[model samples]
Target: MKLKIIAPIAAACLAAVPGAVAQADNTNFISRPLSLLDCLNIALRHNASILEAQRDLKASQGIVIQTRAVALPQLSVNGQYKDTERTAIESFGPPASSGGPAFSISPPVQNWNGDVQLVQAIYSGGRLAAAWQAAGVTRKQAAAQYDTAVAGALLDTRLAYYDVLLANQQITVQEASVTLLQKELEDQQNRYQAGTVPHFNVLRAEVALANEQPALIQARNNFRIAKNNLANLLGYNLPRDIWEDVPLNLSGSLDDRPCPVNLPDAIRQALAHRTELTALRETERLRQLNVVNARSGYKPDVSVFAGYGWKNSQFVDPGDLAYTLHGWNAGAQVSWDIFDGWLTRGKVVQAQALYKKSQISLADEARQIELQVRTAYSQFVEAGEVLDSQKKVQEEAEEALREAEARATAGTGTQLDVL
Candidate 1:
């Protein structure tokens, strides 16, 4: 019994040791091999904002479909019923009093009728044509907006991803510094016991280690935050024990080069492709159509109508009693508004104002895009330059540290001097 308990406890302790060591190693290991394109691709599929924009685009497409349906014929069905009580009436004709007062038509000709009709708009003063154009433009606008959303989301993802990479790199630099200091501290302690170096040297090493600790901690925190952000974008709840190892790749200029296009060229591309500008232009066109429709109010409208009905003296006019039916009538209809109390003029003015406002908005959006593209391009290039500069600085720092160590080992350099 004693041996069995001891064996299980020893085994448990052994397993726990490896697990603890693994956890520590994993936290220190970080991956930095991802690129902007890879991140953008991931964001396109997973970013919530991009998904919402896509859904909105689909809804706009539905609207276009509804507008396109305007060309189809409209059909309607209608019915009516009537009841009457006998009443006498007089009739007047060419004889001044053609019939006695009580001898005229009675019961006011009771009737019932039902009919179904269809109307197809052959023309509408170019309103339908303009509307169709507007719908097409709206769809184009939606597509452009979706593209803009994708681009913006990709930019944000790249920024966050690189932030994490930079944090990890800084952490690595600090950790290496700490290792060197720890070795120096041990050496200083040994020398102090031997009376070869002052205790102050050992104290100095301790101070350096202490100073480096905070930076390392901060870097780790930043790394965790960055990983969390990326995980969120990928729609994951990052595990508490999550860790990654950096993948090494040879440096290539092709992967890091800036856009070669000039600012003017970029602006031109935006004007041609930006979704908001297209949407605004479509809105202006639609407003112009509204103006046309308002003006059309002054023009006359023409349509044809035809109907048939039956009348009988009997109360029940079933299908077999068709002999009591009358004939049918058909004619053209003409309606002219002639004039309203300035309502038409006010509508025209309102539409024109909206059209002018849309024009202004389009201009504003174009200028804004021009500014944004230029600014983003500048920032992108600047980040590359800064990264390159930091790389050189880091290399120089490492070389200097190596030289200092060699000189110190040769016994020609003091502890403070090497530091």
Candidate 2:
């Protein structure tokens, strides 16, 4: 009866074995071997944040064009027609009876006029120049912001890729443990049948084997979740049926490279190379230009304008058309905003406040970046040490397991010892 009860449990455990082994043969889907650089490249192209940053940079370039337009000449042409029902005249001195001043006037029923005008700014205090400078600085800020976005995306992709690799390794480790327990269970059963060990040994081995099943299941689940997350990061919408189809292999190991040893040097490098700080500095420059622009209101603006036009009683030139009645005019003018309810003063105050705010923000960002650099350097060093220690432990465990199996097969060790 004991044998009968144990047979089905053993069969069930063996049935679970094929799943771990047959995963190697299930290759009906896409397979890609990706290195860290490969993943970074793919993310740079498809990541939503990076694409949005590129668009923002293009928008900043457009603003530069708009601001520069103030320094360029503007031209316009217009035409109009008018019809009159009657002509009337008023005399102030005398009428026809007095014969002092009298006149009869006839006016055309329809008139046409066309005009072309050009205006160019000769000077606007320093407003136009400062505005253009601010726009250029803003464009540079956008470029720097885009670089920061790319760096952030690259870091996130690296972490996700490492997660997938780690999960795959865990699955391998769990499978090995399950296999060892399965073998020990079988040996215990053989010894029980030979009447050389207690039935309790068989039960103990079965319990140990069963305990590994839950861990194996958990490891496989973790691996699948990790792969799915990576696929999402790569902008893939894979279906459940195709989960096993996409096989990913990483081309490198985490411990293959040496960590940076000098923490102070790393922090300095981060501060110098980080795009976020560059963007903040550019923002400060832009705010300074804004203050200059606001102060420009105190000075006068100078401009030159010219207009040429033609007018006639008829829409088309008459057959007799003497001169076409064309005229032209040109002049330069300067205008000062003597008073405007203290608006310029208010604008200057606002700009100064914003500039001060940017200064504080830049300082805060520098401190945060320094902290991040130090933390990352410390973690990198610690991880390298932990990896070395884990490798040694793995090697020792394998050797011990091998010796326990050899002694069990020679009937010189108990099943518990092998386990």
lDDT of each candidate versus the true structure: 0.61, 0.72
**Best model per lDDT:** 2
Lowest lDDT sum, 10 consecutive residues, model 1, at 15-24
Judged by whole-model lDDT over C-alpha atoms, candidate 1 comes out at: 0.61
Question: Which portions of model 1 show Cα errors greater than 4 Å?
Answer: 1-42, 68-72, 80-113, 122-126, 237-261, 304-331, 416-419
Give lDDT tens digits, candidate 2, residues 162-264: 7787888888989999998888888778889999889999999999999999998988888888777666666555656774525666564544444235667
Question: For residues 244-341, could you state the per-residue lDDT of candidate 1 as single tens digits?
Answer: 42222111112343334455666676678665677677777777777786676666665565555444433343323353655665666676677888
RMSD of each: 13.6, 11.4
Summed backbone clashes in each candidate are 0, 1
Among these predictions, the greatest TM-score belongs to: 2
> What clash pairs does model 1 have?
none
